[model samples]
Target: MKIYSFRKEEGKKITKYDSNFIMSRIIQSEKPVHVGCMHLEKNGVIGYHQAVVPQLLLIMNGEGLVRGERDEYIKVQSGDAVFWEKDEWHETKTDLGLTAIVIESEELNPDSFMALRIN
Candidate 1:
């Protein structure tokens, strides 16, 4: 989630900064927000843990497997964002590698901007 993408097919084209850029509006939090890049190297894993607050994991590069609640892993790749509610158990792992941006906040609501992922 360190270097996510707009994918060209997603997000709206922005002409303000540059004509070739796209902007994907992610979140607008009234509460304090915390954002960071996560680097999971080959065979890396993020251990299962309960989220203290709502969290959004934005897959930036590579591919990975993630499980939440039901213990079933879902394949995720760049341009995918996964959200976990407070107190929810979740984990992430990769065979090759992946990087993603993690956003955490009590007021985090990704649905306001990004489409819900059924998986």
Candidate 2:
């Protein structure tokens, strides 16, 4: 298993379309861009976007909400992990600030299902 640690040194400030956010890359590969943890400043918001593969967003600290199609909004906090599917419309809003760990993989490990294969 590959281990990734998110420390302060790896933190980086990112801005897109006037939104200021911070991200730390604990693990990343050209096949799958993996971001371990990201800290969003107060009042920060990431615009609607989609991922190439499935992603898991685990909130480690602070609070936020995720908005999706049809005005769907889900409140998220520490210990809350939100799974975002590929090509889905979504956006994140930091209301009470935010800190989260984003985990993703390029391809699904086929070996994981060996024991359950009926064929």
Candidate 3:
């Protein structure tokens, strides 16, 4: 059995066109399997990027838009959770600012949650 712990720390201020803050707290991780919480500040964009591994995003607060490859987009609000596959390109845009907890794991259960990906 593996046990992981999350410790709170000062988040890094991320600026790529919008004011935002990000805190990466590792939940459980071992090589290909990684889980963590991503805390985002209001009106912040995570910028377009690709997921190296399968991941899940659970909206903790606020509203936002997720843009995937080929302009694929999805709207996410409070209590919304999204799943992203590996090697997929994606980005996040917050409408009214947001805070989301991200979980990346290889042991993803398809029937248990929303599986989202970009072609």
Candidate 4:
């Protein structure tokens, strides 16, 4: 069993992300799950990118705007959860600053499922 605290991890600037954006890794496992926390200062943005794997973003505090391939953006706030499928293009920006937990899995395989027999 393992426990991780976001406060313990030091934030690192992600070169690919816009200025004032930083991330701290929380957990990385061979089980396909990778977890991290991201902080975006006011007016910060995460440039458009595509998810190589499935991803889930959980809003921890503040508010932000998320945009997919579409031109429109969706406003999200604390307690909101967002999902992005593999290869889906997305981006995020915050005017009020935002903190969120990111969870992703690259090992998701639809072919590995086994049908269960039911009586």
* Cα lDDT, model 3, residue 92: 81
Over 1-119, each residue of candidate 4 has an lDDT whose tens digit, in order, gives 01122331244667774566656443344666877999999998989999988776766899898877888787877655566678889999999999998888975322222111110
Report the lDDT of model 3 for residue 4.
Answer: 18
Candidate whose lDDT is highest: 1
Residue 64 of model 2 has an lDDT of: 88
Residue clash pairs of candidate 4: none
lDDT of each: 0.82, 0.60, 0.61, 0.67
Tens digits of lDDT, candidate 2, 1-119 = 11122333435778878878766543334475566778899998878887567665666898888765547676777645565566667788896789887767664332231111111
Residue 41 of model 3 has an lDDT of 67
Per-prediction count of colliding residue pairs? 4, 0, 1, 0
Instruction: Please give the lDDT score at residue 4 for candidate 4.
Output: 22
TM-score of each: 0.88, 0.59, 0.61, 0.64
Tell how far residue 3 is off in model 3, in angstroms.
28
What TM-score quantifies how close candidate 4 is to the native fold? 0.64
**Backbone steric clashes in candidate 3, count:** 1
Find the candidate with the highest TM-score and give its number: 1
Residue-level lDDT for 2 in candidate 2: 13
Off by over 4 Å in 1: 1-6, 17-19
Candidates arranged by TM-score, highest first: 1, 4, 3, 2
